[model samples]
Target: MELPHSTAPAADRPSVAHHRPGRARRTRPDHAAPRARRPLSAKVRRYLWYTAAAVGIYGASLAYAHLEEASHQAVQATNAAH
Candidate 1:
């Protein structure tokens, strides 16, 4: 009896030339600015949004750190006073 074939057929292999044919096509309009030349208003809005987010995060972190430091200091003072 013949053993069963374990290898794939010749047609199942991929050719090197066919690698990512769809990547060459441009999905965006060519007439539009390339993200860097956007209007100053748009840039300002984006910057403000980012700045607001950063400030919010920083404020939250500062508040948490201050609260933690105050709590630690209070505990230390109470322990020392005992």
Candidate 2:
């Protein structure tokens, strides 16, 4: 079976002259450069470091707790088997 052609004339159809096969149209001009980002303040940096240290300490504590519990269970099992 064949597909039906458009009833409208070629001139009446929407133009796609600006569109390319692979590339997209840019919203801004090509010559325009992006703005530079501002660096974090000393106070903000200190807080970030504090937050990181806290997270690290908490993770270490959790890992230590798990190791201690596993060791305790192994000891109990050994005692029960003897």
Candidate 3:
């Protein structure tokens, strides 16, 4: 629908940058910025942290299981002796 006092048509809008004929239009190439590279030491440090975390979790779970088994075996041994 056409609004009141709006003389210009919607299709005739000039909402874009106008490049002059004599000037070069600005352009961006695909590889304007090089891919960021993580330092070798930083990568190694990250893997080490991950390895440490996994090992810590595994060790904690193993210790818990061992403790539980030992307590159960001790209870059984005492019951058998009595």
Best by TM-score: 2
Q: Write the per-residue lDDT of candidate 2 for residues 1-82, one digit (tens) a residue.
A: 6445655677867686656734565454655787778999999999999999999999999999999999999999999999
Q: By lDDT, rank the candidates, best first.
A: 2, 3, 1
lDDT of each residue in 1-82, candidate 1, tens digit only:
6545536565776655635677655466675656676557988999999999999999999999999999999999999999
Report the number of the highest-lDDT candidate: 2
Report the CA-based lDDT of candidate 3 relative to the real structure: 0.84
Output the worst ten-in-a-row residue range by lDDT, candidate 3. Answer: 19-28
lDDT of 3 by residue, 5-59 (tens): 4877667776555666345565547657877896679888999999999999999
Where model 3 places Cα greater than 4 Å from the true spot, the runs are: 1-39
All predictions: root-mean-square deviation over Cα? 9.5, 8.2, 8.9
Q: Model 1, 39: alpha-carbon shift in Å?
A: 9.4
What lDDT does each candidate get?
A: 0.82, 0.86, 0.84
Candidate 1: global Cα-lDDT? 0.82
TM-score of 2: 0.58
The full ranking of all candidates by TM-score, starting with the best, is: 2, 3, 1
Candidate 1 segments whose C-alpha is farther than 4 A from its true place: 1-40
